[model samples]
Target: MAMTAAPPRVVATEAALALIARLLARHGPLMFHQSGGCCDGSSPMCYARGELLLGEQDVYLGDIGGQPFHIGAAQYEYWKHTQIIIDAVPGRGGMFSLEGPEGMRFHSRSRLFDDAEWAALVAQQPACFQADQKL
Candidate 1:
């Protein structure tokens, strides 16, 4: 298989990581999950610490505001092309959002998964995830 790459060319500000550390410290544990949301149903999501790297996944588990936040291998792969970064703002605010190097903005939303993600999850753990009753 071809080697997957790292996330986009975006970097986080020191202030952001600092704020995240504070948030995680207060929340304890967290959960980063994904679900079908768009035409492809392909969304990348990560939250608390866990062992779920399925690819060249760059899983980062650290203190985000005192709580643990995780980014799996899947995200690392996609990050290579998106130029996405999680940063801090002037005030306490939302969990996480994506931004580009050109100063573009992409807000976080509910999970969006394509068929591939679902298949991968099912392949990895058949017992997990509910069957698509709509099918």
Candidate 2:
């Protein structure tokens, strides 16, 4: 049987949540994208909702601290076994992210999901696909 209480593949730290709340107050709704490309590498980039254009190749991983997070499908395949953890650090953010002006940047931290967690996530895949709620 499938797991009924699957954990999200992505989450945020308390500090990250606090920062996200502040950004929301100033920018309204927001979203994040972790691109496995050049320049920022795999850093999480924050944007006010609708500011960034998502391509067909993008995959929505899930929400973190209530903000939707996405990644390239190719990247998702590489990261599928890990849980993404968003955190805040004092620095300039991605040049275009909303937080760049706030002197705080969003960072990506990850760890491989434990065996049980991985199994539960895999079990939830069918439900996730049926939802078709990619943001």
* Candidate that would win on TM-score: 2
lDDT of 1 at 121: 37
After superposition, the stretches of candidate 2 with alpha carbons farther than 4 Å from their true spots are: 1-4, 127-135
Give per-residue lDDT, candidate 1, residue 133.
14
Q: Tens digit of lDDT per residue, candidate 2, span 8-52?
A: 888999989999999989989898999787877678999889898
Off by over 4 Å in 1: 1-10, 29-46, 51-79, 90-135
Error of 1 at 105 (Å): 12
Q: TM-score of model 2 relative to the true fold?
A: 0.86
CA lDDT scores, all candidates in order:
0.37, 0.84
- Model 2 residue pairs with clashes: none
